[model samples]
Target: MAAGPNEPKSRYLQYLEVVTGSLEEKRRYRQYKARVKRLPENYRTAVEALERYLMHFGPADGAGAMSMYEDLADLFEQSVADGTPIRDIFGADPVEFVEAFMANYPAGQYRARERNRFTSAIQRAAGEDTGQDGTDR
Candidate 1:
């Protein structure tokens, strides 16, 4: 996450700072809340529900989480403009919809690391020498 001396800070880095709960982050979060509040009631409720679910189960990384939240806001705002129904947005399965949405934000998923670790551990236990690409050598 460290930036080089000559490199400009990226938006992702800015988001990581937001996760650290800086004053600027607080202001941005408040602005985000205000935007959500201005949405029509149904869209507002849907966003709230999705926010709650995402907060619990979405990206573990601060940058990824904030990015996801920002995207969520953008999505509903556009949907409001397009007159999209809730059912049309998420379809028959809300969990499935959320999972699909989460796929776009992989940085926060600690489970990916765990899955790789588990695979490596099993290979070691089985006395397998894996190549750099993770194939058995």
Candidate 2:
């Protein structure tokens, strides 16, 4: 029996699609890099640092990582379009800005511990943990 075109794709097929899309995105980003080199020194440095931060701490999934890259690229593109100075946009510390951006995603090595702490804080706020056992009953 042949699967129809409308049929849902298998997990493997979906994974392949994501991989292909990510590769395409990476190609586009490489082109973006060439453009970045023409930008003013401060803007170029900030954008490059941001790219590195995304590479290190962005989503683990290829698709998600590509999306993050696209978003960051869009931000830089928009800044260029708006004639915004990189220093004005990112302040005196581009690395700090990148770190702050990364903090929003909760990825990286400490994500699990951070998630657990967030869950515990929420549970505590809800008064769900009456004692150390953490039983609602």
Candidate 3:
């Protein structure tokens, strides 16, 4: 998955790829593990929670994870309402949504290390907000 200009090495993006029915998902999961292992301890916890979320809930875990991801969706909706022309949610364009979600999440220690993520998500959203897709405005 290509990490966009203002995106991070996202666990969410990694998660979405593995959750899909793609045949090579196992290999991706291996790379995903390597990626997870390198994250800071705090981020490791979120990745772990995400794993538990996936393992226990199956493909439907996204339903639950949304509590973790929904605010970002809401943020975009608010932006869209205000003439921000972006249209995306959850795993859709996860690079954009994950950063927004992480930036706003009240829990986790990634706040400091995720500075780039927060800023980039905003810029990406702002870029999409310009009615390029005719969905935001």
Q: Who wins the TM-score comparison?
A: 1
After the best TM-score superposition of candidate 2, give how far the Cα of residue 70 lies from its true spot, in angstroms.
1.2
lDDT of 2 by residue, 58-132 (tens): 655544555566566677778988998777877888677777765555363355556667787788889786355
RMSD of each: 6.5, 6.7, 19.2
Q: Which stretches of candidate 1 lie over 4 Å from their true place?
A: 1-20, 109-112, 122-137
TM-score of each: 0.69, 0.50, 0.28
lDDT of 3 by residue, 5-66 (tens): 57774786677767774324445455556655665564455455545644543233333334
The sequence of per-residue lDDT tens digits that candidate 1 reaches over residues 5-82 is 688778887688767755444666777888899999999999999999988888876567777888899999999999
Give per-residue lDDT, candidate 3, residue 66. Answer: 43
- Candidates by TM-score, descending order: 1, 2, 3
Q: Please, what is the whole-model Cα lDDT of each candidate in the order they appear?
A: 0.82, 0.66, 0.48
Query: What would you estimate as the lDDT of candidate 2?
Result: 0.66
Ten residues in sequence with the least summed lDDT for candidate 1: 128-137
